[model samples]
Target: MQGFTIIEIMIGLAIGLLTLLAIYKLFATSEGRRRTTAAVSQAQTAGALALFAIERDIRSAGLGFAGMDPAYLGCAVQAYKRTGRDPAQYSFPLMPVQIVNGSELRVLTGSSTNMFIGARYSASASGVFTMERSNAGFQAGDVVVGTSDTDPGNCLLMEVTAGAGSDITGPGGVAEDDPTVRHLSSGYTSFYTGASVTPERNGGSSVDMLDGGATSLGEGWLFSLGNRPTRNVWRVQDNQLMRYNFLDETDTKSVGVAEDVLQMVAEYGFDKDGSGKIDKDNEWTGVDAELVASKLDRLMAVRVAILVRSSQYERDAVTSAAPKWANGSKDFVMGSGDDWPHYRYRVYESVIPLRNTIWGQQQ
Candidate 1:
């Protein structure tokens, strides 16, 4: 039998090793391409889904509730939750005429958000508020905001904690969420005739109490804010788009809607002179100057941008430069912890008109 030379055996081994190395390289390249494509597709879907959700809500902003009238824009709301984790959650000046990322989008959403105030709600009383009739049109746990006939700017929010007749109490007045405390110890049935209410006294450029007593809220109109007002707030956290129903009155945390989201940017489109149109170049702004209560009425539309990042990692840099749009109005930014160039990004943008408020202006 003839034996093969050691040189021939060595050459055969080397050729086999080279072929295996080539196969491995091809596999790695194919796998990398597949992952990048999947990641890009996922980021695209997330951006679109998030944009659609936000757009739908912004387009339906306030519906017949807060967006029905321009006067209600930036309306001051004082809310109290029964089982709320934070005391400062429900009280603030809502509807600043624009919505943005890292910020909140608050809109009143429900079936019927209107009613008539029956009597004067003496600030001195608690546990009960009366409507035009004894019927409790407002069910228990319904969140209601009462507007003062004397001052529409001054509003009080309360949750019904009692049975039929829809009684309300000050904060801590109920076993749970009674905001009108007087309603808790309110003795009389049907309607509690508490101590006489004093009118608001002013001058000295300050709001004063008459007769050195708590000023009464002259009940004018009652707006049912629903059981736990839907004060929807949008946020971004942990590479996800988060939504916190700030007024749900529960200890529930914010829910995530989209994945791989980096950040969001939003701007305002104003009518300026109530032209029933938006002056994009002259009046579109993201600054706080337009955040004032007086400037809110001029708000016509909102421009929003949502950036989403691909989750796949590449060995080489994918993005060579920073991203910007609309003449650098929205500059793309990422946290320092990111290896940005190794990832891809997608931007979803739109200009949503404040249709409800805009219609109100046309009238």
Candidate 2:
């Protein structure tokens, strides 16, 4: 038998090593690509879910009784306590669309009303008054609005306490009736006998006509009162989108809506010209968020921006692309600074019009 030469044996071993190395490289490349695609998909899913939730709420911001205006939709009434004796006992006023320097968002929703009870059973300026409707749906601690029966345009908002025999009270919570405390007109009048009465809850209330009556309260467009999921706050904390509903008694704890949310920025759009339409060029983009907030009643649209990130780390040692947004005076970034290459990111944006605001404009 002829023995193999040393040169030939060495050549065969070298070729085998080269083939193995090529297979390993191919596998590595394929795995890296797979991981990248998954990360991108995750980011997209998270961003889409977050945007959808926000848009839904924004669109329904001022929805309430028929003909209710959006301008009156955003008022933060004290959150109701689930375990308390009275859920509406401790709520105070909070803005409907409250933004913490453009970082977080708070929204108020309106609860529907049962039919209007009859006119004031008896009238007195004292916070309490009588109604023709039974106390079946109406209860103590319910927020109700009283309007003029003759000029339904004249209205006063009050809380129900100690309901019995068609009697409802607690306007301004004053035992002794004060004519000066009237939100509609001094002294409760028989004119409210047939006025509309609607419930106000879930961060929604009828427009308190400070200058008296703006228009006649329409038929069936009256008072509303009830316990409902009418308000909540949305915010990004610890890379999670959390919702807090003070009005809900069952779940008082903050719940996470989505994950990997880095930041949220919103801009208010207005129909500054009173032309019944919102245009970007005429929007108030002031750096001071409070100024924009002051004009919330006039706001016609809202522009929201959300930043999302991948849940897993990418293997790349360096990356040339990163996400960015112009937030206020600073450039908002994702996976920015020294850790830019470790993750992937995306930005989701939407502009929602305020139906309530538009309705008010038309009136």
Candidate 3:
């Protein structure tokens, strides 16, 4: 047998090592590509979901049962007075106004246990308020109350009369002895009326207007526009999007609607002349006629751009092999900082009706 030379053996070994290295490289490249594709897919899916949720909510912002309307029952009482002072003489007619507080939104309409008020209610410490319910006794177009009332205390409890025709007396007297005048109670049924049988006072410590006074209108009143303890904020923290609803005084539910969102940016569009355009002079920054009209016409669509990051991108870093996939950039950058990298994402937006805001201009 011929013995192999050292040089030839060394050459053979070198060639074999080279071939192994080539194979390793090929596998590594393929794996990296797979990871990159997965990351991109995940980012897209998450981003799309986030954008969809936001758009849906924004589109329905002033719609559905919560839509902006004079009949929303979320209006604040522009003016109110006790119909009469006599016993069983508690009738307070209110002029309906926009929902000035956020907390009152949930209680505006009566629930299963409460009768509908047909008008909105508000709890504002500030003196400025809109007509919540028309003066109790006036017909449509009848001007009973002045433009606005300065005395915030003038707003008393609201009453739903048993019958119609405004036969109810002021809070100081019995229902105007008219047979048309009907007796009404806040309780759902006689079972809810207690031994005291005292009609609940609006400002009292525990005056229950609905559900047999077990719950008070003021309980949810603190969430009004001006009283919202904290402004609603949307931001990304720890790779997850967070929404904070800060109604400090009310028990309203706050929610974080989405996750994996890297960033969110918003722009307000203004339509001037009822003709949609970016008319700088009529931008939404001011409450001008054009701005107001645009808002009413849904000409002011909210543009929301959201960036979603990949959930599994960082896992490869823990492995011994170098990450094969290249980390890509994101479409949006949060704030003024450009240090962070955003992944694949989608942008979603919609226009909403500023029902009360626009109608106020006509008034």
Candidate 4:
């Protein structure tokens, strides 16, 4: 073979270098695409999980209160634990607790001390009390007294008989009997209020009315799926989604529950009848409890949209897209135009029945 010239050798080297560079670029492009697909999938999964959790809780909003007494519901009962008056003196402490105002559901569980300590003055109002008991063998109007003669702080004791005699004695007088007594347990107490009682912000009881002004209550009760107080608007700060109790005045900042929550949207489903449907006429407004009750089967659907913005991709590849519209653009947008910016949009929707409403009908 003839020896190759310097120019020929240089040309051959150039061709080889160009081919290698192209192969490297192809691999890099494939890797980038893989990562982008994974990011999108992850974001979708996260959004779906969040939406499901919210819907599950919302569906059970006002369950287990329709057949019970109004006082037990606590929505209609004004004061829960009496500090000065006698238990028998007043109407058996109409469920001594209520679900107050907050973004999430709140339930007031009385202190154990207040529930069983009988014959003692109703002075301290802060303690974990029992609200229901199936084994206590107590009726609807029986007083719950302290059975532990030694500790007096551990267990709740109930007087099986109602309106018999004053279990609590006062200054030269005996405590009266409460005709509306109800029992409760530790985990979750379902007071059998005949009518539904929605608590007001002022710590007073109101029937099917939500307090529009008040912000915080020591025992602010919000009824959701499992009778535990839950927050609605969770905050995402410092790359974390946190849970905040709007009723907790002390906890200005909430605790983090999830991370990387880019967006969340909530929609109220107005079931005009117990039959679930999205009737325009039966939507939730400031007035109309009947509509609320009849629509008690109302469903709350939460749509959580999240963006998985990671540092792995090149910023130049990102594009600004238009937002997707659901429930119409007019309901969510301001101004009479479509000049709004919508970027890479993903939505997840979850429907939950308001378990706390009489309309739910099904537990």
Candidate 5:
């Protein structure tokens, strides 16, 4: 067999190299497109899942607290528990949702209260109080809030204890220390076995105000948060949606729900003029100090927006601008040092009605 000419061989090699180059370029472009598509899809899914998880809690934010009168709405609930001080159990605004420092979202939710717990009651600074209805709900380890009849300046928070009432009496009887004081009791030694007294959060008394004295039928009411109270705080951390349970003292760690989550923004939709409807769009948005308690009662709905980013980084700028929600009323903010432009983003927005608030208003 004769060897091919050097020129022909060189030409063939050149053609082969060109073909290889063409294949490489095509493969690279296809891979880039595939990655971009995957990233965008992931972002959409992540945004959706994050919103679902967060809205679940936000929907039921004020379940137990919604039944309170307007006077008690803004009351800074004073609390005490034998266990370590949980922020939820301590002093806090009596609102389902409270936005702090502009970005952090605090969503408060308690277990469903019972008929026996909702009835009118009387409270004393001594922590002893009387309930008008059956004290069947009261139990050891139960967290209870006593709203004062005389004044709503503050609310008393105390945990039901397993300790016996007094030396010469039991619960529902005259206090041994002071024979005149008689607070309602669970009528049992313990509803929850490990119940005890908690130190006042502010080194104050068990109650915020004096005992109601109108034949012990005080306007004040007691709300017992049985074992299943939840105080959840939601925020975006490190491109991940993280949630921390303020009520739970055992696990201090935050649980991450969605990946590639960039930021979450929420707007408050309130009946500004008490029209029972949100007349104006974006009128009084956000849960600032003014949007809580009574104003929060006016909050008919909440508009939540979540911005999610893609896991894939692009060589070229995939996102031209930051995502916006609420008709550009709010936008995702990527602080310094973030390679935000090299990523893709998806904006998910939803207007969630505060059903409890809405239902409360109807009542």
Candidate 6:
């Protein structure tokens, strides 16, 4: 065979090598860009979805049961159990917009049409609360909240243990003091003795009780009794945004609102003057049950900040540094350990108004 020069063969090999190198570079560049884009998109989508649910519930906060007057939507009470894997998971219950320690949020929702309407509930000195409503739909083990729109400070929440029809009893009072004729201990039955009931108390509705010996729910208090008292809670847990429904007493199931959510922080605005407008000077850097109960009526707005990260590796391995969120002097850092190079981050934030409470102000 005709032999080629050594230089010619070498040149040909070099050209082939160059072409292969170019292809590799192109692939690497494209993959880097793709990962970056995907990370950004994921963060954006997660942020939007989380904010939507929060805003929706925040706007609906303090909403009363259907067919009920809007005037009743007020911050009535703050009560919640603080026992869980995460302390933030449980905080005080505020009727409308309840910010717990400026990190967690709880909103209450309900409809008046489902349960007993216009039913009156009273708490005896012994802590027994009785409800009397014709055709009352309350059942044993049902969670209920007593609220007075005009009197936000006075509210009662409890679990019904007896009665369903015209009479209902709560988890309080001595066993002997219970209405014996109605509660045979074997089962719940409706028995309305309007005449036999003490004149100081109206025996028309069923009676229930809450522990702690606090007579918060007084006679003539408006009733929003229902088996379903929708209490929505939102917080960041284990790098994700989570929601817990207090209404579902049994499950206490937590649903993931968004993934890769790193942190959630908030600021509250108050309408200290009843002017129907939020005042900046009245802003609360943080809030909790005490603040909610003491200043709930004055709260007018809330601003929340959420931080999220990418679910997959999106950065070049050469740089192990995690992404940082620059918010002026305060920079939020995201990512850690071996996967730090694999992710990017973004922040989603919004300032939402408490429309229900604001609307109540206009009236």
**Who wins the lDDT comparison?**
5
Tens digits of lDDT, candidate 5, 1-363: 999999999999999999999999999999989988998898899999999987898888776667667777767776544346444345666777776655567787767455332546534434455445445555555566667766677776555543223334558885453222223333423444533434222234544354645555445776665546677888888888888866554235788889988888876788878777887864656647557533656877777888888889888876777778886776677766558888888888888777876776556
Off by over 4 Å in 4: 63-240, 245-253, 271-276, 281-321, 325-343, 356-363
lDDT of 6 by residue, 168-262 (tens): 34567423323311211132322322222111111112222222234354443334444455678789989889998764432247888898787
- By lDDT, the candidates rank as 5, 1, 6, 2, 3, 4
lDDT digits (tens) for residues 1-363 of candidate 4: 889999999999999999999999999889877876776676666666655554554453333333232222322222222222222111111111112221122222222211121222111122222222212223323333322222212222221222223133556796644322222221212243333333212122221122112442112221112223222334345544455433222234556554445444333445555455555633533232332343223433222223322323443524345333243331322234333222233544443444344332333
Q: lDDT per model, in order?
A: 0.58, 0.53, 0.35, 0.34, 0.66, 0.55
Which portions of model 1 miss their true places by more than 4 Å? 67-72, 88-90, 96-104, 111-142, 160-219, 249-252, 326-329, 335-338
Error of 6 at 304 (Å): 1.8
**Model 4 poorest ten-residue lDDT run:** 88-97
Error of 1 at 61 (Å): 1.8
Error of 5 at 149 (Å): 2.4
For each candidate, C-alpha RMSD in Å?
8.4, 9.9, 12.9, 13.0, 5.1, 9.1
Candidate 5 clash pair list: 81-198, 82-198, 129-183, 268-286
RMSD of 4: 13.0
Ranking by TM-score: 5, 1, 6, 2, 4, 3
Best by TM-score: 5
Looking at candidate 1, the ten consecutive residues that score lowest on lDDT are: 201-210
Predicted structure 2: lDDT: 0.53
Show model 2 residue runs off by greater than 4 Å: 3-7, 65-95, 113-226, 249-252, 280-282, 286-295, 315-336, 360-363
In terms of lDDT, model 3 sits at 0.35
User: Between candidates 4 and 6, which one is better according to lDDT?
Assistant: 6
The alpha-carbon deviation from the true structure for residue 143 of candidate 2, after best TM-score superposition, in angstroms, is 5.8
> After superposition, which runs of candidate 6 have C-alpha atoms over 4 Å from their true positions?
65-91, 113-143, 147-155, 158-220, 249-252, 281-284, 289-294, 312-343, 361-363
C-alpha TM-score for every candidate: 0.72, 0.64, 0.45, 0.48, 0.80, 0.64
Poorest 10 consecutive residues of model 5 by lDDT? Answer: 177-186
Relative to the unseen true structure, what is the Cα RMSD of model 3?
Answer: 12.9
- Candidate 2: RMSD to truth: 9.9
Clashes of 5: 4
